[model samples]
Target: MGIRVAVAGASGYAGGELLRLIAGHPEFDLVAATAHRQAGAPVSAVHPHLAGLDLVLTATDPAGLADADLVFLALPHGESGAVAAMLPTGVKLVDIGADHRLRDAAAWRRYYGSEHAGTWTYGLPELPGQRALIAAAGRVAATGCYAVATILALAPLIAAGVVSAEDVVVVAASGTSGAGRAAKTHLLASEVMGSLAPYKVGAHQHVPEIKQATGAASLSFTPVLAPMPRGILATVTARPTSDADPADAARTALTTAYADEPFVRVLPRGSWPATAATLGSNACHLQVTADVDSGRVIVSSAVDNLGKGAAGQAVQCANLMLGLPETTGLTAFGTAP
Candidate 1:
């Protein structure tokens, strides 16, 4: 028997993606799936893509998940903390929500307008020194889709001191799926298709998480909703610390940071990242350039918002937590048209 696992919040997009991945993982035995309103229905009723899965949707309660060796909580913001607190101490938990991503309590209150639920070991494995922490952590907080893309795009330069930590800006475009599977007027095909719109401009909840991840003192972030369904392209710009060739410095920093990483790819010179190239994969494609005219280093990164940015990342951290190979049951290649 493989590690028995359960997924809470199974009716949502993130949870469906987690189930899709778990169904193929050789070491995981998906034994339970839970949803609130959809309880007692077949999982396929909500996630049509998982048509053959025989599991029924159970109530999202601690007792229903007690048998799981690991539980992935894809609940909406502010929900995971209470559920996680009720689980047994030995059960490994991964939360794909904002509840545990920020270390600063004040920041959490300021943005989420709720009491801070406390922090978990962050789940972005590619960040320097993060994999080891996840390896030993029983509870992990998977980074936000937008925040992960932004952090990965700028972390190397920030860590290398080649860019000023005080000044950074990121404008990222994400497919509609990043908004969750919840029904919303703005997410309707009529509103989202053929349209590019920005939301939560200066005050996106992911801002504090980005700062926590990259150690940036100040950050301006904007998230754009694109017409597609599942990818993110983050364009990050930062001022260089010195007059050195910012492009070369950025390349060296990114190369050194990701040379041994399995999921992050630093694209060759002159090649830029495109969301299509990373669709449905856990890979993050990256490229960097310096604009001498603007005196800034610009980095672009692409990833499947639901993959590397969410579910796939949860699986990655789970692998480390369980002592399994880092790339087990995960892929780097995207699906092409």
Candidate 2:
């Protein structure tokens, strides 16, 4: 028998994506899929793309998920913690919610306005020693969509001493799906199309996560709501610390850090990252250069919000936790037009 798995909150965008990914994973057998509002509905009813999936959505409960070897908690922030605590101790968990990603309880309480859910082994494998940590962990917190995009672009620079941690600025644009599958007036087709709206200008929830993962002491984060359906394009700029040419140094740091990574691609010089190139894949496309006039180092990173940022990330960690190859059933190639 294959590794038995389950997904909680399978009706939402990320959850549906998780269902889709798990369906294709050869060694992972999806045993149960649970949802709150969509309980008793067939999985295909909520996720039309998963039409052939014969499973019916059950209510999100520990008992329904306990039989699985691993469970992916895709419930929204503040909900996963309660359910997670009740799950069987033998089941490995990967939470794609914001509940368990922060290390500092104070930060968690301040941002989420609730008690800390406690930290899990962070699920960004590209980070130093993180792959091993995820493999050894029973619980892993998948990196936030925005957090992964920014961290992948910023961490190597700070770790290599090519950029100063004190002053870092990131302006990121994310497709509307990052807002989740809920119906909000602001997310209306008319409101988002042809418009780039900036929200959570300074106090984005991912700010703390980015700093914790990248070693950035201070950050100015601006997140934009794009009109499309998926992907994140983040432009990160930081003060250069070395005398070496900023572009060369930043590229060297990024390339060196991700040299052995299967999912991170440091694009060739003069080529920049775009959201489309990373669509439908777990790849993070990156390109680095220096602002000729300001001498500041700039790195542009792109990723599919549902892929490297959430569902795919959870699957990667689950693979490690289950003693499977890190790249098992995962791909770096994106579907581009």
Candidate 3:
């Protein structure tokens, strides 16, 4: 009798996380789960952690997902568009892909090398007026993992006019799960362990989306692939528009902006965010300070990429679209060892 839901890319890291979260959600009945090569396989085969979930994977088909009231398209970038177009218009959708996140067609084509798939209401509820947009949207585009962390860090300062939007810099280290479940020689255990490697130095697909969301005139993003399995630690820095104590202004902005939010926390001064503190939860932990030498505001952000960056975010949007409380089935606290 609950709201029926389906997941289209149910075998990857994000998809598996969605299934896990949905299984625990009180009002969402996961009626269908589809995958490409994972079709016909039991959920446990691919997601060993989901051994108790009894559903068998079905091939990714719009027809198979039609009965659900909502669908989460966790498909790869550029793939969700076609499937979303074929779905019945009545079924609400939350896409955890780059397919619908960008507003600029030219930017999409340049970065993804594909024709534009059009845009959807953005899914980051913490941004001003975004919760209402997500609540009213028939389809929403969830934020990229890195974008989620970086935006949450930088947006408040820009909105408060405390930081110069003309120049922003982000250097983030993300766990390997952000790379997806595909088999690549670079992701081999021996290659990844103890290695902190930076990739996509200058051009990252999330660049335009971040710019569109935060209104930053320019951003220089560098992403490092860390050895761990599931989190993101982003260091976002920006010059201050005023010479006054940017650190205090930055902290006040962040704390005020997210004070009432259920999942984003602006850590108490002197505290810092660590990837371990936000693991396995929808929570994003943040801290603000001024760099000693440059006086630029530095905001450190942390989140489980597969959680708030993808599945947990998609579910939060689904709750709003379904007229349920935003925190109905999501948790704000992360687990610790």
Tell me the tens digit of each residue's lDDT in model 3 across 1-337. Answer: 9999999999999999999999999999999999999899999999999988999999998999999999999999999999999998999999999899999999999999999999999999999999999999999999999999999999989999999998899999999999999999999999999889999999998899899999999999999999999999999999999988899999899989998999999888789999998888999999999989989989999999999989999999899999999997889888897
lDDT tens digits, residue span 156-209, model 1: 899999999987989999999999887899999999999999999999999999
Report the lDDT tens digits of candidate 2 across residue range 1-337: 8999999999999999999999999998999999988899999989999999999999988999999999999998999999999987888999999999999999998888999989898999999999999999999999999999999999999999999999899999999999999999999999999999999888999999999999999999999999999999999999999788888988888999999999999998788899999988999999998888899999999999999999999999999999999888889999959
Least accurate 10 contiguous residues by lDDT in model 2: 242-251
Q: For residue 95, what is the lDDT in candidate 3?
A: 98
> Which regions in candidate 1 have their CA more than 4 angstroms from the true location?
none
Worst 10 residues of 1 by lDDT: 288-297
What overall lDDT goes with each candidate model?
0.93, 0.94, 0.94
- Which parts of model 2 are misplaced by more than 4 Å? none
**Whole-model lDDT, model 3:** 0.94
TM-score of each: 0.99, 0.99, 0.99
* Full-model lDDT, candidate 2: 0.94
TM-score of 3: 0.99
